[model samples]
Target: MEDVKDYEIKALKKQIFISNLKAWIIGIILVAEIIFIGSFFSKMGTFGEESLSENKVAVVRYNQEVTEEFTTTIMERMDEIKEDETYKSVLFIMGSPGGSPTASEELSEYLKAFQKEMPITMYVDSIAASGGYYIASSIKPLIANKNAIVGSIGVIMPHYNFGQLAKTVGS
Candidate 1:
């Protein structure tokens, strides 16, 4: 009888321990998921004080090389701000080595047109060369990081020699 009682108590304790372990593991996973989701949204400007407000400054981050995708995203954001009718100014956050003069010019034209009604600012951090600078030209309020490289304003006619690269890589 004494031995059986002891065995039952040990079994119960083992079960409790296993359950607690599982609960802790699940808790940790849930916390991890929450953190991941929060950071992801935060980076995408989906939360915080960055939300659009009437007459508030709108910011568009243009960090990649100037391309059609960059132009499209800028245009979309600009359109969003235009529809809102309250954002007083648009800030172009620029850091690009620049590419595609045609793309840059199209974006430049859009910014110039938008500026007729809403003010635009250019904040150049790190670098804004070539096409990047071209787009920033129309924005009246230009701010730059002291150490930023601001020029290389010109066109690049691309002609690639991919034969060597293709031979090196089995693509």
Candidate 2:
């Protein structure tokens, strides 16, 4: 009787151990899947921000501030388009207030060079004014929305002319 009781206890412990092992393996697999899926979505820009497409028509979104990252992304897209034989033409859908004059000039020159090789189109969605307009003008065909604010062909110095305000405060 004593031997039988001991054997039963041992068997229960073995089954419990096996069950716990399976649960641990399942937990690890779940964690790994979560990590893999999260990383994949994040890299593909499905979660935070939409990524610039390489093979298809590249969509470059510019807001108030355009950073080096944006410029780099544009350059990368241009390179990809140059390499890809599937795309016959490239288009710049502009929706920007404006940006760095240097970046704008660089982008304009790049587009002009690209247009030399293949057909390029510029379509302004909302307001492609100032530097934005500068870039758009380089392209062959420029199209703007009916109510879109366009054209600001000039340079702006970053100096505040507050002489009148100072005089008023003194008086």
Candidate 3:
């Protein structure tokens, strides 16, 4: 009976040890993945301009569909940059299909005004079509990636006539 109990205790200890080892391995993998992803995004310019240092390039990452929200966020970022003497020029990292042509035009005007104070440049990494180009066009000497798409300068007004379909279906 004593020997059986010793064997059982040893098995339990081995199981617990195996469980802890597995957990540690998983944790290490998770940490490694996070580090790798962070490095990739860091090279891609990430999203925040707060990290820009004094006398360095101030980056405004706009990666959303152009809308009132985009306008508000970018305008606020511009205002913040205006006060900071830490940047010489503004680098806009734009990527979007864009929205609301009027808003884009308005934002373009605002960016133009801001450019009057400090030089503004745009770097379109991904899709910056439609209203996106509208805003980007306002920037003088716009810089873009070799494969970056810069087209579809137009507007979309989603209008549907489902009434005819409903009538035909006799709902």
Candidate 4:
């Protein structure tokens, strides 16, 4: 009889140990998820005090190379501003040397669509060349400094034939 009682106790202890371990693992996972989500949201913004104001102005600064990441960040910011009714208009500040043609085209289209919802005014700080100028051209009422350089807009695709060089080198 004693042997049977000992066996039952051992089974219960094993079950309790497994349940406690699972609870600990689930708690750790929840904490990790919370940290990851918080960091993601924190890194995804350019707006500062203005975004929190009663009647905010979404200030988008295009002061970097217009890559896919840049375009994505701008699109996300625009979407966020659109959802928040507090944003009255957009102040698009520009200073770019231009970058990917595809990203530029994508951004231009998004800006045009965003314009239908809210007013977007552009201001050129220093320069806006190539894809940069291409994007700025979409927004209306653009204000630039008298000396600010704008519009050296064009796209170039260079093709190279290295086969001849490789053959000469006997590769």
TM-score of each: 0.61, 0.56, 0.60, 0.62
Q: Which has the greatest lDDT?
A: 4
lDDT of 4 by residue, 37-131 (tens): 76666555333243224676778999999899989998999999999888899999989889988999999999999999899999999888899
What is the C-alpha local distance difference test score of each model? 0.85, 0.77, 0.84, 0.88
lDDT of 2 by residue, 1-171 (tens): 999999999999999999999999999999999999987887676774433443445444554443456766887888887787656677778877677788888888888888888787788888888788877778879888999888876677799989999899985
Error of 3 at 81 (Å): 0.3
Winner on lDDT between 2 and 3 is 3
Cα deviation of 146, candidate 4, in Å: 1.4
Tell me the spans in candidate 3 whose CA falls farther than 4 Å from its real position.
Answer: 1-53, 157-171
Superposed model 1: Cα runs more than 4 Å off? 1-53, 157-171
> Against the true structure, candidate 3 has what lDDT?
0.84
Q: What's the CA error at residue 84 for candidate 3, in Å?
A: 0.8
Residue 31 miss distance in model 1 (angstroms): 15
Top candidate, metric TM-score: 4
lDDT per residue as tens, model 3, 152-171: 88655699999999999999
- Evaluate residue 32 in candidate 1 and report its C-alpha lDDT on the 0 to 100 scale: 100
Residue 35, model 4, lDDT:
85
- Runs in model 4 deviating more than 4 A are 1-53, 159-171
Question: Candidates ranked by TM-score, best first?
Answer: 4, 1, 3, 2
Instruction: Name the TM-score of candidate 2.
Output: 0.56
